[model samples]
Target chain A: MSAQDLDGGSDAEADGSGEMPKPHTIRLELADEPGQLLAALAPISDNGGNLLSIFHERGNLTPRGHIPVEVDLECPPDRFERIVDALRDAGVNVIRAGAEHFGEEVMVILVGDTVDSDLSDTLHRIESSADATLQDLSLSAREGTDEASSARLRLAVRSGRVDETLAVVRDLAAEKGLHVVEPLAEGSQ
Target chain B: MSLRLAVLGAGAVGGSVLDLAGDYGHDVVAFADSSSSAVDPAGLDPSAVHDRKERDGVVGDADPESVFDADYDVLVEATPTTLGDAEPGFSHVERALADDRHVVLANKGPVAERYADLRALEAESEGTVQFEAAVGGAIPILSTISDLGAPHVTAARGVLNGTANFILSRMAAEGLDYEHVLAEAQDLGVAEADPTFDVDGIDAALKFVILANVLSDGETEYALDDAEVEGIRNVPGTALDLAAEDGRTVRLIGEATADGVRVAPRLIPQGSALSVTGTQNIVQLETKHAGQLNISGRGAGGPETATAVLSDVSRLE
Candidate 1:
């Protein structure tokens, strides 16, 4: 969340090499409580998302009777998913997000030493190496990491890079002695 | 949940909606045409009303004005297209929105000519306006843009007018002149008897303006006059032939750009996305991140257009 660590996320990155930040707009439904706007804005700034502007439509109420808020921000595409997650984690209702999500998406399951292998680092490496973005993830360690823990990952990769992205994950999983359940592989029955 | 419905303009589109609403668990509480209308609190029989209108030339005892006051959850406006001021269609939408009723518009007038006004009305009203049938009859183009969100659609363009496309396609394939093909289209009911609106590119331009406004997310509210329109009326068969020699075909393409809306006949390579023939309509959206999205289907028909209207109704909360 540090400004100095802008390129730290697995979704989008701005390496301070002068890449123009991508502009995104998110439509939200917020309770008309005091500090709701601030509570919403905190996660955006926390995730290295540059604030562009916010239009809190005080007069208009969505179907849920909550005030409609439109927030415009600029960030690298790689970091957008993280910013979205941070907003949701902060309990902000996101009705709409950035339009330019990755075109192709795939789901894979990894079983074996998930916690010990450092899932966050593995996700970051896959996104950075394969030019893929992590979307939704589910981790389960019911039997504890000593036996086998499984994690389900939903990834949004650039079109035509699904095979390569899966390969990157497979290579990393091989080195870590983790078993990968491939869903996007051509030979998968 | 059964939806109480009020339908305006019981023409091809409206009548079709009346016919199919029951299948979707929606009841046409009130139905209106230009001359006579029917308003019922419970539910109106679609067959009885349609038969009365066609057989006896009268729909019901109530006048069109009474339809406005009818109790209903949603107002389906299927009126004919009237450019310029957009007339009764615009006023119908305004009244429905003001009365806190959701509106599903198959008419192009309110959305195309009066987009900004409609947006203001929608912002103030509890009810929302959906017009999937306005642009592409059953192609789901407008809603697709909404689903994709506004900022991502960098540019959108396509062949919007089926009548124009039909005429041009026939002229290209059969080696017939524009006049001959247009006459054939009229006989086949593919083009209107007057055919001025479609051939002169005004119809396509209106739909293009609507698409532009929707894609921009109201960043740009393009008026009918703002578009630079050149219809396919003057297109000759020889031109299509010449284009065909180079593996190209002439099509009436309506495009929305950052500058403004434009409608004209352009030569595209055969088998390309925009090279659709006959009454087929194609919409292609150039997105910022999701690459390009292309949707094509029948652009206009009684059942096809009504299907779009019914889809909008089902989408209503």
Candidate 2:
């Protein structure tokens, strides 16, 4: 993970004057090489983009055995497309690139008969109803599926949508007689 | 100034108040359990009262109703918390206020459940009401809010219940189940024999409801029924394990704003101010001018809570 410099410089002439530099997130898949992250980040800075943060998921891997990296940068509307094209042009596999997508991650634990309640269906409902993406899940039912079980879910939600997502989760859990332990809002701690 | 005090309820808080009132330069003129009372115009001996209560199960030979007849300046209400109507505690406070006497409460029921009625009674009389012990014990939460001005304080939140926090912290620390940790807490006397009030989030909810009532400043009244509460009973060890993996831990946190109160097991970053382990408690106040203020201390205990009650007594003119 790279340090997030929220003050991403005042150099905003990449896409001409009178246009504000909007934040954009780009996801890339890299091989397990020494310079893979450095190589992947080069195209972002080379395309006149100001780097904001680099979330390097070293412990996590793509299905094809590649490291996943999420880079947040500030660029004008037209320049964001150019940065994505330049990354692919430089042979960096750009998996996802967008401005109005996942901006924050929230984790919650749901405890109940998750297995018998059709956990997959519950996940689908959460994703659709909450406008969130199922990022990861870890279910523990050591007492067997017949008994109470707990599942920890990591959901990728758009920024400022955490409260809405949690309300949806609480409603769904209530319907199934499940309990949801939500993460406290950022900075409230 | 030395003032005469009539303490209600002979529980831990009331007993400690009787024992320590002399040290604080006050006199317990009257003391009562539910059944009996002890009154001396000057001051009763604390040890003698304790011995009589221990041996005969009565604080004194006087009738419980006779406590009101004693010449006391402050009424210390430390009865067990009751919900809904808040019981005889409310009636005791009402009687004290009607006599133009100050009331210092260690009981949460009257404050949390019947805030409007209590304040109305206070408004009708010349006396004032201060209930610092009703919130975070010995943490001076209410006094700090008073110093900062309740309007300047935006919100209040923390691990208010020590018993629930003890169970959660022990579960996270030893990777034990909730029942196992709760049993250990019971054996250690950190939790009561019937842990429903503590573990089910009622105790914490009541405290936060009191905070909410205070923060509202008589604009909006809050009660235990208004709080959205969730206990720590359903939180498994695996959930804590997962939170620990991400540099976080689960705490039975409660929040109170002018809007309302909420108590639940939420994930907070490990080592944060709110992540107090064992039977420790912490309170975070969101203020308008001061950014954020964190006050941590023993939230509940005989001596610890007596300090709050005594401090409230001293604040009264």
TM-score per model (chain B) = 0.98, 0.99
The local distance difference test score of each candidate is 0.79, 0.86
The model with the greatest lDDT is: 2
Q: Looking at candidate 2, what is the lDDT of residue B14?
A: 97
Off by over 4 Å in 1: A1-189
Q: For residues B1-317, could you state the per-residue lDDT of candidate 1 as single tens digits?
A: 78999999888999999999999998999999888899888899988998899897889988888888888999999988998889989999999999999999999998888899999999999999999988889898878888888788887888888999999999889977777788899999999889889999998998889888988787778989999787875455545655565466678888887868978776566788787889999888888898778899999998899999999999995
DockQ of candidate 1, scored on C-alphas against the true complex (2 decimals): 0.01
List model 1 lDDT by residue over A42-141, tens digit each: 9999998899888675644655778767788898776677888898899988865763446797766565654334675576467557857666566655
Each model's backbone clash number: 5, 0
Q: What is the TM-score of chain B in candidate 1?
A: 0.98
Native-referenced Cα lDDT, model 1: 0.79
i-RMS, every candidate?
26.4, 2.1
TM-score of chain A in every predicted structure = 0.48, 0.55
